[model samples]
Target: MEPALRRAYRRESEETRRADLIAATQELVAEGGPEAATVRAIAARAGVTAGLIRHYFHTKDELTRAAYLSLMDGMTAKGSDALEGVGAAPEERLAAFVSASLRPPVLDVGAVVLWAGYMHKVRTDPELKTVHEAAYLAYRDMLQSLIAALPRSASDAQLRAEAIACNGLIDGLWVEGSILSHAFAPGEIVTIGLRSVGAILGVDLIAHSAMLPDPGKILP
Candidate 1:
């Protein structure tokens, strides 16, 4: 069978090509929707033959699924870096997580656009549902672990409740902050988040201000 027209591949490592394809799909979906990331469109945007997509991904749906995961992975990958860089103290790690979530890239409007675009598909598409469910749990579980690790006295049920509360607080603040980035000063989200979640979990987040990844960057 003849292949569709696309630009020739330039020098790129295997990982780079695959990442490029996934990223191309994200850009397309972010600009339009899931329907915009057709194989041909992805190939043309990636500057590679459509066959190359098949080489990396067996089907267009597979490519889309990979792209969906790519977006989800990007959400957490930076969180991992921020946590690791700050050392293992529970308060510091929690502070880092709070600050990172409320900062740029995470707090920007583009992230909200991409997430809302795919959120509808998650309800109807099984593959996307699995990705969404798993990622959501993973994030919540990370919070659960952090909540449990905090140097406070709490039971299993109490800790789980605290984690769930923190998750909701973060999610709500993320959307509201992303959309209204102009309204809140930089770091305001972090301050408000830690304060709110701290009350939810009975932790003194303000005392941990020194542990914040970006301290006092928020202005009045």
Candidate 2:
């Protein structure tokens, strides 16, 4: 192959291998949690040698991080849809952000399970903790901007404090909704979360309840 063709071929091959590894990781995590997404198991699923995973990821930690990021980045890409076609009213946009953040894509069990597993790991690993914080900051910034667009005036400190509280509440609800399947009905989780969050942020989420997901759709 020519140099350019060879480069293109290599890029395609790498992408394919990366996709294979991610798919394997998802399956392993869903079936056996994060611990099962080992290099040996991933390689066996991908039909590649364990050395190939090493070639792409310097360490097990690196591989785990990559897998976690790939999953989360894919999920966060939907953030754009939060504002799509909605009139740019601050409250409307804020509700959109809240709804999107709280709702899990329950259509795919593997995705949901892997996401919960990675989230659990982030609590224990320093690097993953940083990554998790950065992701939350990005999400909260969107909410902050939407709040800034509101007509009501508030001090910067007040707004930041409210945003932090709202984010924390949503994050806790997410973990519970995603992991503790037996404890609460999905509907109860969303209803209570929306009500409490609305009270804390001084926004009436119930009025714009159309944006909220029906808990029936949220159960995988």
Candidate 3:
């Protein structure tokens, strides 16, 4: 192979290995909490040597942090991706995003486990705490932007307040939906989320929910 081609292949291989390690770490953490994701266990899960983890991450804490960040990023991306082809209407976009968030794979038990597993560390570790805060801010900021785009006029302070409330509502629903999924009927969470958010924003999000690509598809 040409030198450039060889280099590209090597880089891709390295990244793939790194991702596999992180995936293994996340799986272990979700299954048995953060304590289960030791370097040796991660290596065993990934089918790689423990030394390989050192090649990618300086320490176990570093690897765990990366996994946490990846989990949060994946959740955020799911909500953002739902906005695509959702039309230019702010209400439609917001409703679609909320629906996506309340359903799988964002609303899965494993994802919630991964999040909960990291919470203890996030409290004691400054770097992890920063990651947690940044993730929260980013999610809230996205919601704030969506709320701001609505036809209703609101000051910056009001928008921020609404975003915080809406985020809290969604977070609570997501946790309940994940932990006690059998408690709610299909589409119940999504319906409640839209109506509650609508009430908060003083806009009928249910009216715009029809704009979703397949409203019945994600209602779990």
Best by lDDT: 3
| Predicted candidate 2 versus true structure: per-residue lDDT over 1-220, tens digit per residue | 1111111123338877887777777777777778877778777777777897888778877777777777766656564475676665666666666666666562234566787788778878999877777767777776677766777878899888887888788767776766675677655666666677779877776566564342222222
Model 1, position 102, has a per-residue lDDT of: 71
At residue 53, what lDDT does model 2 achieve?
Answer: 81
Q: Which ten contiguous residues of candidate 2 have the minimum total lDDT? A: 1-10
The lDDT of each candidate is: 0.79, 0.68, 0.86
Q: Estimate, for each residue in 103-187, the C-alpha lDDT of model 3 and write its tens digit.
A: 8888888788789999979878999998888889989999999999999889999999999999999999999999889998888
What are the clash counts of all predictions, listed in order? 1, 0, 0
User: Number of the top candidate by TM-score?
Assistant: 3
TM-score of each: 0.89, 0.74, 0.92
Report residue 46 deviation for candidate 3 (angstroms).
0.5
- lDDT score for candidate 1 against the true structure: 0.79
